[model samples]
Target: MASTLHDVARLAGVSIKTVSNVINDYPHVRPATRERVEQAIAELGYTPNLTARSLRSGRTGAIALAVPELGLSYFAELAASVIEAAEEAGVVVLVEQTGGDRDRELELLRSPRLKMTDGLIFSPLGMGQDDVDRLDVPYPLVVLGERIFDGPADHVTMRNIEAARAATEFLLRTGRRRIAIVGAHEGEVIGSAGLRLRGYREALDAAGVPFDESIIGYTTLWHRSNGARCMRELLDRGAEFDAVFGLNDTLALGAMRVLQEAGLRVPGDVAVVGFDDLDEARYSIPSLTTIDPGREWIAATAVRTLLERIEHPDAEQPARLLLADFRIAERESAGAALDSASAALESAGAILHQGAGADA
Candidate 1:
């Protein structure tokens, strides 16, 4: 038979209530008493009956995580990080994929399945800012991604505009004046692609580089094939771009392969940079230069925030918009190129501002 709370309490020379207090991390417990309880728990291999605890606490002891396709490296890696964080919190995670379909994302928000879990950590790709009202559900919710903001829940996302600007500036700094962008969704106002594109334009304006529409590669998806296809399209149009910025690492890698196949040497004839510092970025042919968007922090913070909401449903805290910090990962892709890449980026900022003025 599995060890019981009585066994643990007896071994620790503490009452059962003391063991329960330690397990629940209840404040006011003496440090020495908590330590003894933990020691007894480890020695006896005591595991709490989560199902019973949930019955008493009126909580599920589990959380739901809904995202787009997990096949995408970014989402897959994020889900793994979330799972690890949930486990550390002594909670289970129920994962669901929405295929980035707008209807499905909306359905998930109102689904009865949400009641089975204590809270939800949602990353909606298809849903836009207009769908913010759907987030007004009964259960606790924590939103992730650039699609929706100012919703009825806490939000966690990367600094999309700033990070994209940094990536574009990195390419420009390498002496690449004519930079191309891939994996952009044209006329996108609230999505990740749109925001990142805006950031790219901002960086170029600040650097004094003229923003050329011909150099902007548009795509609906941020897939590898989309990257390659966009690069081919740019080449076919005879766009004079000496560098490429893929909004995501996958797109950058795809674009890099196509560029190489077209006889363009990476960082030699053309330099490439990507966002989202994925594991594959480090192993790419020339090693990709990308942005680290605080993935670990995002995952842990999302779980922590959700749990707090779940514990205190009546808490009057307003929805939060948390932005993750970003850093450029210098590698062979852009690092080995012109030593003046940083200076070039500084000049491109002026160019970006000029473009904005023309638009205004």
Candidate 2:
């Protein structure tokens, strides 16, 4: 049998109203009274009826998370982190994919399905800065990614430009010059690829290296295939580069595969580095050197900020922007300069730039 609120109230020697207040975490309850109620709750194993409570409070015990596509490794990993964070907060997450289409993303913002959840955490790939006005909706919302900024909601994201700069600087410090960049989106200004590209340029500027547009590989998607395709094009054009920077891990991994197939020893022939320190980065044949973009922090902070907005809908506060920290992960894929073992490979006279399948 379910323990009733009345049973808990009777055991705690408090009125039913007092028990209600305690359960809701309402202010003004005395400390001793709260303690007594808590003890009674523990003994009676009383769990508040979330359905009834939500009906009265006009809130659902769930939040919605919308991302471009979970098929992409980064989004899939991010969604998992977000789900874990929501579970810790005693809330459920409803996930939706927008396929990275502009119209679909905009339609999601206006969808009635949002009413089923308390708030939304949205990551838009196709939307731009001009679409910020459309975020002025009725429900609480927190925006993720570099798509739109200075909007009417809390924004949580990583410092793409700064992190990318750090990644470039790391490669430069390892004595790798004439570095190539893969996964650049043409004409992207406020998007992740654009910002990361800017960072890479800044790093080169600071290092006194010339910004050669010829070494930039453009792609519409940051997928593995796109990375491989862009790298292949760069090679076909006879572009000379000592290292490569993949904007994301998938792209980096993809580029690495092509480089290996073309008889280039990773890090030995052309050092390779990528962003997003994904779980797979450590297990690649040669391992992958990448960036840790504070993914866990992004997930937890998004949930916390959304809940705050949901709790105080009438509070007049400007949108909040939170940036996640990033770090470089040193691994073998960046080449012999990154680790002594890779240097040993270099000493073995293994031709780094042979062709794929040489030693893969």
Candidate 3:
């Protein structure tokens, strides 16, 4: 026989209403009481009648997560983290791919399918800041990504400018001057490309390095293919660069591949660095040094915020912009000059010692 809500309430020493509140993830439920109810549910294997509950509560116990493209590694990883966080709250997630088209993103905002979910977490790529008015919808919404700021929703994103500056400064510290950039969009203002480029410029200015426009590679997309294409373009232009910074890891990996394919040895010919610190970044040849932009935290916080919005739809909580802290992951790609020098000395010493012993 299946355990009923009444049985869970008895075991938890709470009213049926309290049990229901906890099951529905109501925010006001006391922490201790919520724990007790959760433990009771675990002990008795109680499952709520979601179909009946939906009819009574008018919530589907699900949320919609929209991203530009799952083909991009960053978005894919972010979606995975979102799914994990949603599961912990005992809710389901429906993911949508917008392909980063402006029309598609705007249409999704007014889609009737949103009624099937409690709320939405949107990461727009094609929409600009001027389209902020489109976000003035009647549903609970949380915005993600570095696009369309000052919108009418709670925004969650990583610190792009600071992190990008850090990455650029790191490359400069490694004895690499005349660094080139991959993934620059033409006339981008507040988008990720522009913000990150701004950070790179800040770092260069701080380091007293002159900014050269010729080394900037332009690309509309941040895909691996785009990275490769940008790198080829830079090469074709005969740009003189000692280092390369890919806006994201996928782009970095693609650029690195092209560099190697063109007979330019990584770290020996030109050092490379990237952002987003995606999982693949660590395993690549001459593992990429990149930024760890609190991605998991962003996903967890976004899910929790959306859940809270659903829990208190009328609460007077002001829309807030939360920035995730970021750090640089040191790896082989950001080659250490001192380490290479030390290695070279040790190798020469070993060779000399072997020759002396053989002569003796």
Which candidate order results from sorting by lDDT in descending order?
A: 2, 3, 1
lDDT of 3 by residue, 43-76 (tens): 9999988877787889999999999988888999
Best by lDDT: 2
**Candidate 2 stretches greater than 4 Å from native:** 1-49, 338-360
Q: Each candidate's lDDT (Cα)?
A: 0.87, 0.88, 0.87
TM-score of each: 0.83, 0.82, 0.82
Supply candidate 2's per-residue lDDT for 144. 94
Candidate 1 local lDDT, 91-156, one digit each (tens):
999999999999999999889988779999999999888888999988899999988888888998
Ranked by TM-score, top first: 1, 2, 3
**Backbone collision count in every prediction?**
21, 12, 0
Native-referenced Cα lDDT, model 1: 0.87
Of candidates 3 and 1, the better by TM-score: 1
